[model samples]
Target: MHEMAIAEGVLDIALDYAKQNDAKCIREIGLLIGDMSGVVVDSLTFSFDMIAKGTLAEGAEIKVKHVPLVGRCTKCGKDFRIEHYDFWCPECKDGVLKIVSGREMQVEYLEVD
Candidate 1:
């Protein structure tokens, strides 16, 4: 699965950072994943667990923060939260929407000892 690759990347970053800081071990990993990021949390967690073995983050707790979809109306310049995959603007109703959030996949921080 693609989650394996994703997990490998995350593990690489965490290990590199831990080595740089001379950490004994990783305690926690904070991730920010948006609704539109197309990543399944459960799958990612499982992949991470499998990939992190024998590493500094072997027993680290992964915390995922979900971000809701948000969009900005191009015509009216109004920002609103998107629900149910609707991309239309509520105010002007004819404006094209540009997604402002809910498409990100990033590591927020790592708690290392």
Candidate 2:
């Protein structure tokens, strides 16, 4: 699955950082995944576990933070959290919504020792 590639990329970055810092092992990996990022948490975690074998992050804990989708109404200038995938603004009814957030997948930080 695509999660395997994502996991491998994450591992490469983490490993590179750890090596640069002379870390013996990785303790934790903090991830920020947006609702619209399309990265499955369980699948990504499983892939990471599988790929981390015999590496600095072999036993590292993965912490995931989910970011909700937010949008701003173009007509009413109102900002709201999107519950469903509807692009219509709830307050203005006729306004088109511009997505503000929730399309990101990023590694926030890593804990290494």
Candidate 3:
């Protein structure tokens, strides 16, 4: 599954940081997942448990921070929360809404010993 790859990548990054910093062990990993990032949180967590085996991040706790999808209206310069596939502007009821945030999946922090 793609989530396995994503989880492996996350561990790879955390290990790289640990190696660079000479950390003996990793306590936790933090991630920021945006609503529009197309990542399944449950799958990611499960894959992390599998792929983190024997790595520096083995037994490390994963913390995910969910970010809401936010869109900016092109016509009226307004911003609004987007639910599902609807991209219309909330303030002006316009169709020219551009995505300003969300659509992100990244490691935000790491707790190490």
Candidate 4:
């Protein structure tokens, strides 16, 4: 699964940061995951846990914040949350909805000691 690769990336970042900071342990990691990012949180967490063993990031808490997909109407200039993949503007039936956010997957913060 692609989640494994993503986990590896996360671990690499954590380790690199810890080394740079001279931290002996990594306590937590905060992530911002979007609805359109296509990352399964459970799978990603599991993969991270599996790979973090015996490392500075071992036993670290992975905190995830969910970001909803928001879109803007191309014609009416209205912004709204897109539910169920609907791409039509509610204010104007003729307006097409363009994505404004919710396509991101990134590490936000790290807690280390």
Candidate 5:
């Protein structure tokens, strides 16, 4: 699964940062995952736990903030959450919605000790 790869990447980042900062252990990892990113939170977490067993990041808490798909209407200047892949503006049907957020997966922060 791609989640395994993603988890590996995350662990690498955490470990690299901890090593650079002279941290003995990693406490937490903050992640921002968009709805359209297609990353499964549970699978990612499980994969991370499995791979982190012998690392400094073992038992580290993974804090995830789910980001919803948001779009802005070009004609109506309305910003709204896009549901079911709908691209039409709710207020102005003539305007097409442009993606404002979502489709992202990134590590926001890491707590180390």
Candidate 6:
């Protein structure tokens, strides 16, 4: 799955950072997941658990932070967070919307010991 690749990339970055910092082990990994990023949280976690064995992140805690889908209405100057995939403007009920956020998945912070 794509999550496996994403997890591997994240682990690679974390491992490199840990080694550069001379960390003995990783305590936790803080990840920010956007709603539109298409990265399944559960899949990512499963992949992480599977690949983390024998690595510096073994047994490390994973903190996933979900980012809301924030969008700006094209018809009206309104910004809102949407839980559903409907991109319609809440106020105007228009289908035109400009996504402001919720399209990113990145490692925000890493806790190492």
Using lDDT as the measure, which candidate wins?
Answer: 5
RMSD of each: 0.7, 1.2, 1.1, 1.1, 1.3, 1.5
Tens-place lDDT digits, model 3, residues 1-113: 87888898898999999999999889999999989888998999899988888877889999999889999888998888899779888777876878887988899999998
The number of residue pairs in model 6 that clash at the backbone is: 0
Candidate 5, residue 57: how far the Cα is off, in Å: 0.7
TM-score of model 3 (CA atoms): 0.93
**Per-residue accuracy of model 2 over 1-113 as CA lDDT, tens digit each:** 97898899899989999999999999999999889989999999999999999999999999999999999999999998998688888887878888888988889999999
The residue pairs that clash in candidate 3, if any, are none
**lDDT tens digits by residue: candidate 1, 1-113:** 87777888889989999999999999999999999989999999999998899999998999999989999999999999999999999999989999999998889999999
**Against the true structure, what is each candidate's TM-score?**
0.97, 0.92, 0.93, 0.94, 0.91, 0.89
- The candidate, 4 or 5, that scores higher on TM-score is 4
Question: Where is model 4 poorest over a 10-residue stretch in terms of lDDT?
Answer: 90-99
Model 4 lDDT at residue 111: 97
Q: Candidate 1 at 28: error in angstroms?
A: 0.2
TM-score of 1: 0.97
The parts of candidate 2 lying over 4 Å away from their true place are none
Q: Give the TM-score of candidate 4.
A: 0.94
Model 3: residue 98 alpha-carbon error in angstroms: 1.2
What residue pairs are clashing in model 2?
none
lDDT for 98 in candidate 1 is 95
> Number of clashing pairs, model 3?
0
Candidate lDDT (C-alpha), each: 0.92, 0.92, 0.89, 0.95, 0.95, 0.91
